[model samples]
Target: MYAQVNATNSNSYIERYKAILLQHPEFTPFSWGSNTIYIDTEYTLYDVDKNGIPELIVKEDRSKYYIYSFNGTDVISSDVCYWSYDECLYEYEGNGIAIHDGGMGNMRIENVSLYSMVNNKLVWSGELMSTEECSSFDELYSFLDSLTPINDFLPITDYSHLSN
Candidate 1:
């Protein structure tokens, strides 16, 4: 299940993604070397940074997400606020900011931060509310629930059409 490319902007990260995906219709953002949660997932391409180029976003049940950005020469990865840890959940604040709520009581905390894809890597632009501040997690999901995700996920099989 591979695509044959004749010509493309080889320097473009988008082309690189197309090459990888068109070559493997079952493309997945992760391939955990050991036992891991690599199943029951979906992906989509979106211009997450408003940079006119689409980035690959992978997620499991829309709870845990992984962002893959291209910085010209390589694919950058950032799962920080996008990922979940047992009880954590993610809510995209649009732009590059990601909101994470996890734990309870003393263990409960809210992580609100802005991130950026820099030089082939994902780096924290800045922490709006540092977890070190021990900001209590909001019990009310009203605001959070009222908001919608950047979600436009699709099966890997539908992704190959991007370059065709």
Candidate 2:
């Protein structure tokens, strides 16, 4: 299941695909893709670059596969290719894509780096990490607060399980 949030209106909207939550708005499920990929012994959903957008980390036993995306749209693919060899138990690093705005538009990356694409080619952009590196809960909150661009950040609400 996934979650959906529409901020187009003055009053932001949020909804969940399917799932039961305890009693908090934070427990509300978000709309997500129904498609899944099998990797290792467990199905893993990765945010790719820790951004809000996520992609299914399809794992096929011992191999790694990615649900490719282009401009935030999942590419229609049915073939699985050898992305990398396994080095961990159930997690495969460098096996997903992330969208980045390279001072122009959005670009995809397998790994978050200090550099990103430029002019349709990979080039040095800038370090991804800021001075506020995530170290503690307070730091995380501070980093989150530091995000200037409002739309880039998602609203995290704590709502009661009470229905409308």
Candidate 3:
């Protein structure tokens, strides 16, 4: 189940989340417009790499996400999405990560693309399928599930214990 932070405790929760981020020298607090972004219902902590340490999966909104992981000492982050139209649905598939670009446009699909995390970076595999081609969301997901990882797995300490 997903944990959703309440508005009453959001301030305290942000404070705690900020404190954790401060421990990582490479982490810079993100801001949108004039306000600072904080952990809330949009964030999910999980071991995406299957390593014991949990990675911070921050879903800034329905269309944007950022994944932060501690590579032993320094914290590293990868942009899961930058723009709303090009935003991709990300998931850990098989032994690696898969990003499904559902594409954009009102009348027709523009850019239907799929990406695999090769050495912790997104590598476009090309436009194999389009949102128009899929009959259901399940079919799109199944297609993404078929892709394989390009890099070998890197194991690290589990960070789930620090999720509190």
Candidate 4:
């Protein structure tokens, strides 16, 4: 996987993260007996608690997620979630078909959500497939934007509402 740090912050946490990534060549893709293993890396600065300074979340392969401070040095925590499923297909309006096995074509129909890291967990709560053609980043961005802010975790009035 490739890494990019914000150029504006020369001595920022992102820079350090990039430096570490560069030094540790293991972060890049490596071949193990002809089977290639990719190390997908991602970074984000978000205010999980609305504390102004953003907390960092680093994403890796196999739906693994790590939470780190913005300083980019210390790892706070990590969470892993499984990502695998199947969705049925059917015909629909405005849908196109592709020839599978060089035979009669089948149009993509049902959409199955895929998993990606959110906060520190691999969440499969977003739409993975859509009728429209778009990049995975576009879908991931839409999902990220749709996340609800964690305002109040512990409400004194009731605990039954925490059944989510």
Candidate 5:
């Protein structure tokens, strides 16, 4: 499920849809295609920028995804992609977090970006592929495997606790 800060209490507002979260004081009304969007609970929490804190990645729908990074008191949200199918694969390299969009089922690589905390915000520093270059999924996977990570952020050792 997706989560957001409750804005009033230390408790976080977690739910499957933005519309439901909107019921809480922390969220404001935002227009979208529907309020019935379901978020996959299987999320990943990793330090994308090696800043001693981890960012939360969750799938909002089949094509929409978000990455949230905490900065002391509040959470910063990053729109990872609107055309992504399934979940984004994250690799903790010596530099930063390498995110690959494509790998589920027959999905081909659509985009690859490296995210790191810049000025307290998660920003894309590099792009592996911006256009449709690979014709097959295997080719895309091979290309993704060959890419060199740009961010040299350290990896978080304990990530299991974040899921619980």
Candidate 6:
């Protein structure tokens, strides 16, 4: 009943999201090269569900992403990702849809799937296409190209210090 008791409006969720980010264990300054993701304000948030309240996307570690959303009763999180030695990428489509595509190398576990936040729960809404499903990169790219291209995402930024 977190959302029921606490959910008032979209802005409230954003504020709550900020508070959770501050207390997040993996909510640290993260960057691999030129891209840096920060947890500061609304500019960096995404409304994957189109519920007016945007969800927080956190890249916790090497290959794990924690997506948080409000279920109209309380805030909840989707399962964190687990990438192999080579993998990292994600983007959102229109209507609260998200797609993640990554994986390469010998031990790599190729994966691509669509996700959506419904009723405060993050669920896989599309079929998962892995290396087993797609024979080669060409096949994978073709599949990806066929997907809806909302490509909604904010540029990665570094404002971690601002939260401090």
lDDT of each: 0.51, 0.28, 0.46, 0.36, 0.50, 0.56
Model 4 RMSD in angstroms: 16.5
- List TM-score per model, in order: 0.54, 0.25, 0.45, 0.31, 0.52, 0.59
Weakest 10 consecutive residues of candidate 1 by summed lDDT: 1-10
The C-alpha stretches of model 5 lying farther than 4 A from their native spots are: 1-42, 102-109, 129-137, 145-160
- lDDT score at residue 74, model 6, on the 0-100 scale: 59
Residues 73-150, candidate 3: write the lDDT tens digits: 444566555534323444554334455543445664433455544454445666656666768666766775665432
Tens-place lDDT per residue, model 2, 1-164, is 21222233321211220121111133222233985543322223333333343333333344433231112322222233343333221211343232222122253212222322222122334434332344554553354344332122111222222122
Q: Rank candidates by lDDT, best first.
A: 6, 1, 5, 3, 4, 2
- Candidate 3 matches the true fold with a TM-score of 0.45
lDDT of 2 at 81: 35
> Which order, best to worst by TM-score?
6, 1, 5, 3, 4, 2
Which 10 consecutive positions of candidate 2 have the poorest summed lDDT? 15-24
What candidate 2 gets wrong by more than 4 Å, as runs, is 1-41, 68-79, 87-164
Error of 6 at 144 (Å): 4.1
Error of 2 at 123 (Å): 14
TM-score for predicted model 1 compared with the true structure: 0.54
CA shift of 158, model 2, Å? 26
* Candidate that beats the other on lDDT, 1 or 6, i.e. the better one: 6
Model 6 misplacement above 4 A:
1-8, 26-44, 85-89, 92-98, 101-109, 142-164
TM-score, candidate number 2: 0.25
**Per-residue lDDT of 28 in model 2:** 23
After best superposition, candidate 2 residue 99: deviation in angstroms? 17
